[model samples]
Target: MADSPGSGAAFPSQSPRTKKYSLTEEKIFYMNCRAAYLTVFKSSLENIISKDQLYLVLQHAGRNPSQKTINKYWTSQTAKLNFDDFCVILRKEKPTSKADLLKSFRQLDVNDDGSILHTDLYKFLTKRGEKMTREEVNAIINLPDVNADGKFDYIKFCKLYMTTNEQCLKTILGKLEVDSKLKCQQFGSHIEGTLERDPSPVPKPSPRVIRKTNQEMFSNKGGSRSPLLSSTRNFKTSVSLTITMSANSNQNPKLTEPNLIEDWQCVQSKGCFFLEEDGKIISHQYRMHIPEKSMVYLTIKPLKLSQVEGKPSPWLSVDTALYILVENESQANLQPLCFTELQNREVFGWTGELGPGIYWLIPSTTGCRLKKERKPVPEEALLVYRDETGKLFLTKEFRSALSDIFEVIDLDGNGLLSLEEYNFFELRASGEKCDEDAWAVCRENFDTKKNELTRQGFMELNMMEASDQGGDPRDLWVILHSMGYNKALELTEACPFVINIHAEKCKPRIKAVCMEACNGQLEKTICKYVLTNGSAKSMDGYENIIIYTYKHDSWITSVIENKLDNKLIIHVNNELSKNCVNNKGLNTYVVEVAPKSTMVCQHVMPLNERQEWIYHFLSSIKWT
Candidate 1:
């Protein structure tokens, strides 16, 4: 596979196990219902039923058992059970012949006991529990009550219990058989209801069902074997009886034929057309109905010439446009328009329906509203493009303005114009010749070997040259003023820089080197200075003056300079020396200052006060 654009390179495919199912609300609700029914069934069967047998019954009724539990049950020996074995347990041992029933009862009389009492009934029911109902219990007792005694002997109990157990098993198993004929008829009624709501113009019997029963059984299409259900004839079931009550009722059908033409009308009304399978009006077409407002895309094609003037006039043809009628109940009286045109010489239209009793003309000139062709907007050229060296490069429209003067100075087509080019323009306005030596210094220091000065380089060179002769660099500053350097630096630092200088108004550190001492201070009396790399360390010495200590970590540094009464106080953070380290070496320095030194240092550290408070609270307070 090709690498995706702008991604640089390709990586190996991810593991297949990464995908997972998202169990939405509807899915969880369905599973909860299935689980409830499964739990009830398992309880009824007790320990005799295997999980697999129960799963089969639930599966037939449309339920998904988790694979993990199914696998665990299948491999477990305690729970493994065959369907036949379960059937035998459900039926119990009962006599099919009356002769055998009498003989079996005789065998149960272990001690020639003549009568069965409460003990025998209790033992039988204690094992069976409520599986057999009260009515069943009465019937079993009455079965062998010989001589109308109203009580069963041991012999009577054995015969009657076996007979009752057989009847119960047969009833439950009979309920489980799947009726194929019923499935087909129900699926058929679903299809017919859709057709009745949205009848097609084409004359053909609508599909009443999906015929899943036939599909499941038949292996070959035209086999010699007769179909279990008749193929050519329609099958009817009790569903028609249910349908008769609501046959003409206003209840809408859940499924309907595809609105091939209905969609075409929506597009046509807005002055558009639709073609292809979406608007195909024909017999034996397959369609399904989705819930209203469900997301679905519809396409449209214009009507054609022959279709417009048909033998009988159809709503859509080659000349007709399509329109859509949307039901927008969310917003009051909202009408949305969608239209498309034909790239070909002529157009075609298909029949469409809007709603009950509303239809469209297949191909008519007056059927659609005509759309006028729009004209293109006019454009004008501005100036020819030029490089930084003032060389023409490309022409552009007048509306296209240069970002800065550096764009005009890039003469060699290099990204950055050379220093010579910058000086040439700087001096051009002044009506003075360019200084060759000064220009060389600016070029060597600022311009990259591409022999180009980037927008930034051009501005810096212009400003430096202008300032060297005591000239204002405002012209250069204006060209690069769009960029807010202070804002950019502030965002990266996460906070604003604060400059504090406490100097006397009379004698401030305002000289070139001394003005630099202002660092970042609020004194307007001192001037602003841009400190480049090497220029910073050159003026580091401050004789008899306290210099703020430098830090090398992410920290909030606060510097305060006091110049009151000829005294200076410096506070360097000496917390680490006082708390963490105490060894004295050459690496560590201790300075002693005289009273007139004009500077003082102090170290402050934090104390664990919470510990002291907790200790006091526990010792002084008493519990009531």
Candidate 2:
């Protein structure tokens, strides 16, 4: 669920060469490449945009240009620059103004003496431009007149950085023009206060139930996808839901369009799947066929400044894992709703399946991959395992990383797919749920149409399931390391493996049921109304390595099954209490198991829904 900020390929302010700029210079050069993309990788990276973070955002926006003018936007077909080619770097990029920050402080004031020193304004604000940090040049050398003796005035510090960067570019383009008129409204969007009805509401934050561990990490076989190389106030959320529907007796269960929350608004928890397209409605969804019983009522809020007054915000909201699809005949329960605010909004709920009809909830981040446990083999399966030709051929760098995982599972590209995008890419590579007779055996053995699939039939069905596993790339490395591949097989949504976060009293999250799977996975459906759908109960570990645990009320979703014959190495831990998550799919993980593969290692959950998780999980296995 990656490209959808009304995708013109994720973000297109205009073309024909940015239609000769101006939309306020393409929204201030697309907000200085989104403030150098939240200063080089927001929740830490992987929507690709490097050339040293666009020459450190054009040397901190003074635009020093040149590295052969950023090597003509790195072509060979633009090597790297997503986020709409890092905001049209394929050409237009001149929006620094205030006379280009006073001609870069008059060429770093080298004796034209408006004033300099303090080691040449700390190497012109850290090695020649906007790389400032050392507490932002000690808050500009402790501001107030600035310089008991150090030095100051380069034309009053370039109008004190052009009056705080033209009011921080008009307060971030007035909060992205009110998030671009509530994502170009057709309807629904109201939250400034008014959601008061609570006899008892704020009591839903106690989900962190995990169990599976022995802990380990090796990596070295000259193979397992390249000798295991390893590597957030990540506060970015978008909430807007208002589903309300009540019916049991006094009629009114069929309205259809009276109010699907006024035409659906914000469910964007940045890791989208709040699926309700901007297409004004059709197959994008808007159902209401009830023959009886109904009581759906959702209000979740946050975003209303006259519903984004002028609309124009594209591609800039993604962290991964945000859902709300209320489809149920009940199969584990299909989770990811954890939001819990109470009086002013953000709560989420669920009830039975007593039938009659009325179940259109819609909102998803693709049922975040869920979790498990076990022992023995407990000390040989580390992380990376090379496979230098141990055979699952395909290489041209694995078909350009499986055509970038089929353009991130073709969300709405029209190349084809949709059975909810191959069951969200078969639940992040096999944790289960592709049904419809396995999408009709992937539309009768590949290359489908109308029945969807396509993209050369999803790369000829992953090269015929890696040649029916006889060429075993462990189901293509569990769909390329659970969608963030690396074996120099390149793809990096970056940071996840302890990004030196130090919150101390609080703060640090990234776990919407972090994917890691094995075994015929599909259990975490809110504890399957007390275990039923595949409840073999207990068959104690071994039989080709396995790990299982899927309890949820707030967190803990794991699954792993590698009916081993070869490629093995598992060691997931994710402790889940007083939660300290360091991402790579939750704490202390070291994966590489592909024999008869089944994956989804972790997706913990918290960072909002009124924060409070104690999730747990642990596993141990290793033996080639």
Candidate 3:
């Protein structure tokens, strides 16, 4: 016999005990090889084999076997070999499956403490070309470390590697499935074309109603039907239904076509165009319906060259300039509201408030410059409103009156009306009678505790009420009067002026003014300063001083100084002013002294028991 590779080595003569031990060792080797292959590859003993499976088995067995050797045995003419044959060729003598995993974990653990530290994990990953920041490494370590000790035990380390391998396999399989679907779709289309060319009529097969589970629907299946195929069938059906419904709908057929406008003809004259009673162009190209005077929504279709020339013409490009012409009834003149170049858009909409009257909507390609020439397009333009009137006729008057009233009562100068301010305005409107029901409604809608009423809110409320009453100005007036705006002008004129100052400057001034106004009974009265800035610090050391400059252009500063001086005439004297003075070359600080009020710092501070006295004194001062 030829000498084998291990045949030349010296060996002891066979004995009965040695023979039994050798048999036992062979059995143990076979068992370990099977376990390692099954655990690593996750395959059964009867499954077909490939070179990739052999590689994984060898890798799991901690053996660096040659790829050529694996291929020569696994890749045979049979195309698929069983697990037993794979083991026979690869040599069924291997270490335990978990030994390799344990070796890898030990390499990462480094300290031989049974647990891998975050630093060790980071170093291991870096060695494997995974560049990670310290934070990222820490985050990954914390994931498997349930105790959050920033280390991974043997079990966790194994689990992490297993999960990573599964995720990587799933990702690769997903890409392969996507590529297969694209190829299948292309093939399916080609097959359908060939079937369609057949002379004989073919019977259609009934669709199979397969109820797929979530896993099946989302899995990588090369043979099963893809979601894309089903979605495409559904999309085709929906398109067909849409076409059938659109054909029966009332919308102009031409509007359904891209970049096409409806062709309209003059009803009364050969050349002159006019809007129909239903607010549509003579060709039904443009349409709008005004339900109220305040606003209207207009829809315009793209105009064609033929529609503009009143004759046979080539189709115009979708990118054409379009202009809106508004004929104001009050002015008896046409004016351009807005204009834009049309693109491949579904519909051009115009929504805004317009004055009451018969307004004609003329679409022109020449922009607003066409309106100046008083020339009309050959195609009749649409009428936006015919004999329509705005319900809120006194919109300007109402807004102006309310704005003035709000300004008078907005003592904090925060641009919003507070509940207390609203209440005071109500008192003036109702001759000092409180309307609790109206107040409750206002509070519910405005949520005065959370937010104040803005100007936009007031205008929107007015418009809503006007719309509800069929655009009647009288109804709006009634609503305003009910809210205490009937005597707004009278109340505004009689209202005392309120000054706005930094709370830091005004706190002591308020105390001094109260003491002076109440005949030195400051301790008996409760004085509170409403701090608009919402600062948490007390203004004890801070002094309220007005700086005056000789520069005449300082009109704003001078005006404020004059008001502060007039208000503090009773509290500030020449001697006290001299003590707290900071006079520069041109600027002088006029300091006014007063006692500080002991109260909680808040946005809204109220003076109890002496509300009228404080209001009178504060409102007497003027704000620039």
Candidate 4:
């Protein structure tokens, strides 16, 4: 998973240097750059904000800044950063208030016109004072101004901003390395310079060939003095903001307390009066463990009420929750009860092998306030994997945020998903899940019987979910039905491919006596008889039977033996029916071999073209 929201370095809000730059500096810089582009292009600023850009900005390059630092200097912080610095932004604290957003917006509107006129938009832009042509503004307004109103307003601006921001954010999030586009625009020249120095670009690493030289450079050689080791030791110091909620009011801690490992402080605020590191916040998260098998109730207090900012609310939930089965404490090590199970509930009681330990919870679009009210004892622990898991896993708080990527690819929850089911998540956003080579890569790296997946699978699936879809696999319900399954839903909480569905035309049924035979794959090669009416009628002077066989690893071959009592038979294989050809009065029989099978692994009838396909449709069928 990517770094948790709270793991990034802090930029102190009260830094002496920051005081020199007004909070509007950052927003003004960004708005100016955008205005510069718009001015040069003679277009509205609408296209300037893309989804990818918004997501990247929201994540603050994946850094989390403190609310104090943000409220203090948000308007002044520039989005421009070297690739390394951009990453630092993701951990910064996200602005969680409408007031803060309006402040940021005002910074963008240099003229304070409640609108960004093409001319005013250019004020902060650094185009060397280049001006936008009137024609350009007209064109931009025409394409984006759905209302066709003469001038641009907040509604139109927002529509355009959201559309572009969604696209840009996806692009940025999908990247495993620096964006090729960004690199091409910014560092392409630098790379060329490096190539000129070496006359050869670094060779790409192959799976089979390990780069021993690079490995050794990073490896710690006991008591050895090396340049790399020297560089590693030269690092700045950092501290964590800790909070120990105590019952006594007199116990309030101070920054100078002896117990303070490093310089730290606290504030008595209405909400979380906890310690916070000094720094600008980019994005952040908090994870706390609830006792295993405890009854959990959760609720979120809205941090922001406006969509003025480009990305979704930064306050988000984790993907999976742990419900450790305490009785069989041995299983607790697995974190067996992942967030997938507890994601949807504001309150619920779970009984299981909750080993004695801490279990973390993540709530979405809001922080969670958990109150445990139950004890764990003898109830058998049952695991749940469902729609809620998809929601939970997307948050930075969950360790398994990327868990959906590697879930088994069965969109129909049939214990298997074919290549088609697997692709559903890959063909989504471009590079977030896997390289452009995801389809080929996953095929080479998946399991069949166990339906296992790898990290590559998870990334590909995750990228898909977070992109065009609602960031939820359940949204792919249509895709699932189109693929021959019904009621497509998410698999376990953290897995995208482990779906549940019904086949339109499920297993074939045998209402009357007939004869059939199948090979291991059930191709339906031969048939002696098939049932036409509800009953076999009078076979008169004919007999029928069905046979199936397969081989074992060592020597033994398993064979299914049965006799044709002419009681009931359903023809599955077309070939089998053909073989039983032209019986006419001799009692004609038909058979066709379809891949349909039961959950218990019994070979059942495959649906005919006329029936609506489903996976377990045979559940209502009467059998002897």
Candidate 5:
């Protein structure tokens, strides 16, 4: 893998990346649609709007505005405005009676608490003045939105009443269903859509890294300079995380496969052969798709002639050479990164970690020369691994897993997953959501029906994913595992993964840690990363689970022991923490632990690279 004697030059320097790509116009339109939300709010919403905050938001959002532009609007640093005040600043006319109505309600808020208790309001409306009925008072309370504390903001209630409760009711109704009738309505998509316009802040699937070939370094196969592979499945030693699917998926009790699931082709993940027969080499170039931030390892395992029954060996006893080809995003430019030969070790090749973007891996004998064979060689098999996963695409096991996923996300029991339904799945993975523009991309690329992703289309999409990631299922596992699917791919009722944070620093925060689990994709991902074969309805059945959080300088370690035998999946969410020190990293974990086994599900060092480590555990996982 060194400058192949054939490579007249050193490996070329990779092109430097300077800026993020611009977003599509459709995503921009989706983002701008958020303005429509303020329209009813033209009647009404997040934090206080300050010039500094607005400038940061717009700049990060890709507007790249000058301080002058923001200054024109913000005017002064001391000037601050709430949502309603900001609306007035926008010059939208306020309803004439709204202010008077709010003032009148404020008179009833004796505590100046900005809200009136439902009971107090009910007394005022029914016990005095215009003398309204209990029913009428209850009806009005439903308009604005009441806090769980049993109070509603009088001003907000007054504004909603003026705008007509219909708008409030529409928003509330949309929250109640998954596939709402509201055209393209999505929470937080508008703001995020603009951020994606820069593509820098957000990470889509990435291209991955590059590793200098193993030759220049120490070889694994002892004296063999770069023996391709030494499988006792060599990767198991290098991989800290191993993703395996249950082979006996059909027997799993909790996973219900769709009765009407459709079939599609399983895209093959491996390419290349070096078999030599009748004094000639039998080989052709193989194409591989590499996704973002992925590591690709090319390994060829030697198979003895007797081990493979009738299979012939590669013509490798003599020297042979192979070239690795890569193409740019548009497939417009084809280039060779490096070449591998049967140098000291006939079977060895190279490993590399690449960047973000779509690229192809081509291993061919076409461009390289092969030494004349003196004698035949043993059979050889080529294996490709992306990160820690190398599971083949479209196996019976994968199909079973994906079919269950389609069923869970379909939401309405419909065979097709709508844009909303699919975005729900997207959100499950990587905590990012997409809109019609993305859905349009899916529809254009895959086979679809009725403008939604059919089961077949969904399966095809995953196949492309498998192809892109070099057969790594880490991304898919993260979504499913977080959803409550144990290692056996069973969705436990509601058992949650636990988090143990060990920190020595006082006031060390764990910020933005959000965890949720249901029959959804995102939760499935958090749990998916760490799981084993275990199935139980809930964590209530397991006594071994323990939760520990660190904020103050004191260290609290609680390692509870379990006595239960039931297998289960669990997601302990950090997002729902009532109040604690500030935090970073919004993460959801679905963990599976088995009876009598003490497994440290996940060990994450803080991005700050301090000594802080977050530990997660899985409930149980089943492997066939």
Candidate 6:
């Protein structure tokens, strides 16, 4: 009474028969037909169905069709149908019974694991003489692998299989549209019979409406173009068309533009923004639109070590937190606008709605807490930003040299530097010239008694030097040099202070002065120099003195040299200078150096009688 299932005859009794079947029965029938088609065709469901395969499926569905008829339909509609569309056609054909559907599923589920695995499916297809690559088999498994765990659950598989048909059909139709347009543009001729004979009943809009829609879809509206769709003109004819089609579809008319919707989806999925070459938001979000004000989209990419010049330290990693701080032009201090704590190699972005005004777009990696007690020291922070016009800018006054230096030297990141760490930093900053004398000076002046230097202490020391009373950075250089931080003085002069101390040229002269005054007992001597107008009349005039102490004889000595003439003018408590003066006819005078003391010295000594200090000043020297 009913045409054989494979006979090329219309299902004359299908309407009455379909009415008898419940929804579940119909679904069973659809799944049976789908299983049969997949098994018989020996191909994946997601793969494009060939014309001969479609014809065979049509015949099996009881839609009787000759070769000529099938060809006409295939050419008129999409040349190929994906598995989802094939399932839709099977549903239209109606199901026989639930028993048959269960049997078909059982046949495919050979391993009977309650779900289908790619390996199981592959074996089944191979037994059926289907030659498919591993990639094809995996693609089929992924079709129903909604969770992407490499396997398909039976219930989820069925639900997704049925619901995704419309989306698949839309994607195919969009591809066809793009292909047809490309053909028309290339050949300047339409395929005569193909379009007119299309079997689907999608109503066509007028030429004017189509043209207007195309213009709207392709127009570059103020936003940045998506990097994914950058080369739209070069898209493949058969690629997954993400654009929503307008022809006879239920999609919103205003949202017909593919780029806008696709871009938004891209950003939402990635949780980050990418900018095009023209500084436009790559994945622009249309939903984030604000009224009367444009959105300022921000994106920051983590740079590799090689990308940064003179990177202060290697502690910076790809996962470093980046922040964008926004401050009003009238505000004196910087305030944070937004921040992103990204994973290693992650791109960060933010969108903000603001009116036209001068805004500071400061950026930082330092996680400086805004609490009153945890505020960042301004001198140790680096602030970079961009303007409204997208011109990159930075704060020239905010120096990070101290922070960079500290970070490089603080190997343990404990906010404190041990003597070794401080010395290492000093060596790096100033080189080998940062000898014991330099460290001693640093420790004494900074009160680093426990052989530790806190970050705060280092910052204060830097600040004190930077903002010194004379505004001469070399003043710190002189102090550091006197403290035996010769290398540190040099480095400070070169980097943060940027002074030309000529330390290398002065090294030999200073060393020779110490050797002569200390009788070559340089290791037992502590030398300190003051750069000042050496004239006795100048208030800043000070003696160039070396305080020497002998470890062997417990002898103390003070060697004072004339700054202007390099003359060894006087010695305090120096047995050698005293012996040389007494034995050799070295011109000398007895001068009172303190309230109750006198010392023999050359007459050329650059000191007033009241200021002529004792030769034993080392024994009475104040620790401070």
| Each candidate structure's count of clashing pairs | 59, 66, 2, 109, 73, 13
TM-score, one value per model: 0.15, 0.22, 0.17, 0.18, 0.20, 0.16
What ranges in model 4 sit over 4 Å off?
1-23, 42-404, 408-417, 429-446, 450-624
Candidate 1: stretches off by over 4 Å: 1-76, 82-101, 107-178, 181-624
For model 3, how does the per-residue alpha-carbon lDDT over 470-559 read when each residue is reduced to its tens digit?
654564443343332323211100212221111111111110000011111111111111122112221123234222111100000011
Residue-level lDDT tens digits of model 2 in 190-275:
01111122222222222121011101111222211100111100112111111112212213222121134333221221112221
How well does model 5 score by local distance difference test? 0.37
State the C-alpha lDDT per candidate. 0.27, 0.39, 0.32, 0.26, 0.37, 0.32
Using TM-score as the yardstick, the better of models 4 and 6 is 4
The runs of at least 3 residues in candidate 3 whose Cα sits more than 4 Å from the true structure, single-residue gaps closed, are 1-394, 432-440, 446-449, 461-496, 500-624
Winner on TM-score between 2 and 6 is 2
C-alpha RMSD by candidate, in order: 44.7, 27.5, 41.4, 33.4, 29.5, 41.4
Q: Is candidate 2 or candidate 3 better by lDDT?
A: 2
* lDDT per residue (tens digit) for residues 433-549 in model 4: 444365455556543434435454554444445445544454434333222122212111111111111111221111111111112111111111011111121122222222322
Query: 1 or 2, which is superior by TM-score?
Result: 2
- Model 2 spans with C-alpha error above 4 angstroms: 1-58, 61-349, 353-360, 364-456, 460-624
Better of 3 and 5 by TM-score: 5
Which residue pairs does candidate 3 place in steric collision? 264-283, 391-471
Q: After superposition, how far is residue 532 of candidate 2 from its true place, in Å?
A: 32
lDDT of 1 by residue, 1-624 (tens): 111111211111122222233554433432322232333343221232566664564443333344543443344444533322222221221124546555645554445665544445545554553354556556656664541453457455445545554454343334322433322221110110010111112221112332344443244333221111222223221010000011112133222224442332121111111110111111100111222222222323332212112233122222322222233443223232221122122232222222221111111122111111112214322233446875433222111222223433343334565555554444333424457676566567774556555665654554454445344334423222211111111101000011111111111111001101111121111111111100111112332232232221111111223233443211121211111111111111122223342221211111211111100000000011
